[model samples]
Target chain A: MKKLRMSKATGINFLTYALVIIAFVVLQVMGNQGMLSSTLKGQLVPICAYVVMALSLNLTVGILGELSLGHAGFMSVGAFAGAVANVALSVSVPDTGLRLALSMIIAAIFAAIAGVLIGIPVLRLNGDYLAIVTLAFGEIIKSIINNTYIGMDVDGLHASFVQNTLKLEAGGRMILNGPMGIPGIQKTSTFVAGFVLVMVALVIIFNLVGSRSGRAIMALRDNRIAAESVGINVTKYKMMAFVTSAALAGAAGALFAQGQNTIVASKFDFNTSILILVFVVLGGLGRMWGSIIAAAALTVLPEMLREFADYRMLVYAIVLILVMLITNNPAIKNFFESTMGRIKSGKKAKGGAEA
Target chain B: MLAFLNHVINGISLGSVYAIIALGYTMVYGIAKMLNFAHGDVIMVGAYICFFAVASYGLHPILGVLLAMLVCTILGMVIERLAYKPLRQAPSLAVLITAIGMSYFLQNSAQLMWGTNQKMFPAIFGKTPFSFGGITISVTTVVTIIACVVIMLALTWFTGNTKMGKAMRACSEDKAAAQLMGINVNTTISITFAIGSALAAVAGVLLCSAYPNLVPTTGSMPGIKAFTAAVFGGIGSIPGALLGGVLLGVIEIMAKAYISTQLSDAIVFAVLIIVLLVKPTGLLGKKIREKV
Candidate 1:
């Protein structure tokens, strides 16, 4: 009887995966046939990127129980690293596929390095202090990007190494026109690429959570002293979670930079970090599936409400407060639990209690 | 030497404002153990209140300042009752996030109500300068310094001597014990927020008068900086917040002067990182063991 129940559950999980795959394929086909609007197609890249960011951030915030506001700093580092790699590789190879793959790897590696550098000192601090330090780190990175000078000056327009590195010679300089942002890069991002990335991220995160290391991290979140007494290396697990989340965020940042026709430093400001954080919190922390749904829903919500531009953020703030109130209310939680309990009991009674 | 003196004056003035704002952060954190992220926005709200009082009602700047403080005190109490009281027993993170949500709500509401365009704060000092020895100081700077010191002294006196202030101190030390001893925790918490927010209002008025530029997001930078000051001085230590604020302001000014102006924020954060690494409890914070 237990085996039969297990088989039924497995079948349901497989069906869910199959449906997701089918939906993705349909969307891709529609997009390629120009059945979908370009605006939505353009938005797809960011939506995918935000999903990676939100999920990765959940590792630290939701799983490891740490508040990190400097995720954007890591993303900025990754974006720049990826842009440079793409530019350099194009100059040397001039091939599309190899450059895309290599740049993503390079971006991930560089972002991970930055993650370790920041995590060493920041992870030592707890709570609001950690949050403030991370926030400062993000702001500092922005300030540096704004002030630093790099690459060529052509007709009063200055280009950076990222833009110029790809060109065979003088053309490379045309790529990153400094603060003007890199333009005209190949839009290699497709529905397949995004879907594959999301699937891989989900699989890795799921497997990690199911593993001993993931359990250790979650245990640390529940009770740090108890976890420590149980011989869990609290610091090691926290750092691992932080670095893993940073790497994922970095990968997302690379995709975001490469996917867009134009990129600017200002786009990845403190506000962007806060927006990503909103996704993690509003989704209900520690719930992976909830985060994914929240990310997609919030991403699409703003676009749908674009006509009410002035009231958009105001409404978002209201919704955020409302969600927090509703989710944390004990009365609401009890109501849902009791209703679900009754339904389950009714089904059990109808099916026969002998099973 | 002259450049150093100039930086010193600039630092002290900035520090004075930071110290005033940091008091709000430290006070609220002391009693509730919750970081009031909206405290800075409250400062912004205070500034706007004063702006309306001066611009719309045609009141004197002094009267405007008092009115702003009064309004902020009431708003602070309302926030405590509406948002914070319910989350008293929730985990620290819940209250922290709620504070952040409130911050965002207040900022966006300000933008929606006042519009996003920057408003000019009228300069009350009228280009007056006071010279002492070889150095010259703006009248606004002198006034701000004097105001900060006077308020600090008044607060110290109030907290040390007054009945309600003593009750607040007792509550901060132990909420349940204080409640058992017949001190009303709810009223004490509300009063703490009121006093803290009123101090923020004073800082806001001084900030606007000195800079004369106001925007909805103006509170964020100063807010973060003041929070940093609060942490640097020690999260719950009032005098430590003052010292830390002064030190932070001086460091920032010096960094802007000696190093690249762009790197001032970076340098301040680096100091924070170093401080946290060396002493995680901040400069004056007492180490306490957490109970499992």
Candidate 2:
């Protein structure tokens, strides 16, 4: 039975990998055939970045069962840190791909450091308090970034808070112009790069979820007291999950920034965080495959419904509410279960019930 | 010194508005145990209603205020019934997301109906500054402070002396127990939302009058600020909301005046975080022990 269970889990993982690979291949073929729209072509890299974001957020929200309202704060951190690193390395690293990879690594490290700093104090609180603290931290980070000015010159990088005191030489470059964010960034993030990042994120998350620590994290999420009774180090596991999630978000943020000509801190504000949360929630919590599909579909939906520009968000809101209401309704849940049960029986059944 | 006094008065005036808004947030949280993210947008809707009633229809300012309150009260009850009622047994995450969706719905619908133009809120208090002991204050500020005090007193009395208020308290303590004890949990919650929304309307008018910029997104920032105030004061405490709101406003104004204007938000939030870390239940919250 255990072997069967392990095989079933692997089956889902394999399916997820296959789905990503197939989508990449199909999209690549379509682009090569000139069958894709210019707008969609531009969105490919961003879509991949968002998919990675959703997956990382799922690690915290779904598996760890913690609602972080400031996921974008980490993203903002990573974006700026990575962008600065990328710009500083422009001379030393002539290769754009190598520079992008190094920037992402630096971004991940900075974000993980931030995560540790925030998660240490924040994880002490439960429920609403934790959510609010994360939000407060997000706002503080945004406010601080809004006042920060960073410029790179022959003298390396100079950063100032609340004052444009960076005395840049003639050939110096301003990496971050306070509220204007990082501009003139070389677009090094490609669809292929984003795809690799997504695969890496998936592998890391899946491996963690299947490990002993992941079980401890989920156990604490399921019941803190019970997890403690079983000798699980609650703080250590929560921090591990949170920092890992933040690091992934940082990498995704670096990719997202590289995909854009200009990046602003405000772009990763409360609304953006909510947008990511919406993807995670709509995709169904803790379901990696569901998150991937939901994030991609929702990201594309707005673009496709450009005709209904005014009503698009209104429709999205109504749909979100309806989905929550319907999914939570006992009658509907029972209906889905009965139908699924029937289908399973008709197929003379597979392995185990994945859920 | 006089400038500092003026700042203080301005801070109090601003804090009074936040206190009123924070009351709504605290009350709803106490009863429903969910953050109504749409409360901010409700303030926007209320402001728009009042703006239309006064600016377009030439109604008396008092009547406009009353009209906004009545409409917002009904809207709150309707939102509760349509969106939140069915999700009573659902997870908190679902309820929070639904609230966010409702917030988006309100903001977008307001945009669709009112168009995203900024309208000047009519100055009902007649633009005269009140000067006393060399300290100048706006009439709107005085009226706002007085109104906050009056509302706080009235709320205290109603909750202490009224049966329905007692029922609300009971429900907040334990909904299932309250239901079992023959208290109508649904009605109590609906009433809580009604009262909360009505206060939101008053806060909306005051907020716009002080700043005078009536836009679809105007209430969002203040709504978030008031929520921070609610949490700072103690999420479930009424007087705590008042204390938190007032202190938040004062700190924000002082920070803006004395420090970099851009960092004022950061300062206020930093104070909140420090306060929460030191006293997680807020200034006046009663600590409850967790059970296995």
What is the C-alpha lDDT profile of model 2 across B1-292, one tens digit per residue?
A: 9999888988988998999999999999999999999999999989999999999999999999999999999999999999999888888888989999999999999999999988999998789898889987888999999999999999999888999999989988999999999999999999999999999999999999999999889889899999999999999999999999999999999999999798999999999989889888888777879898
Q: In angstroms, how far off is A291's CA in candidate 2?
A: 1.2
Tell me which residue pairs clash in candidate 2.
none
Q: What is the TM-score of chain B in candidate 2?
A: 0.99
- Weakest 10 consecutive residues of candidate 1 chain B by summed lDDT: B89-98
Off by over 4 Å in 1: A1-23, A29-37, A93-97, A152-186, A331-355, B290-292
- DockQ category of candidate 2: high
- Model 1 over residues A185-243: C-alpha lDDT tens digits? 66666556667666666666766766799989999989988999999997898888888
| Candidate 1, residue B255: lDDT | 93
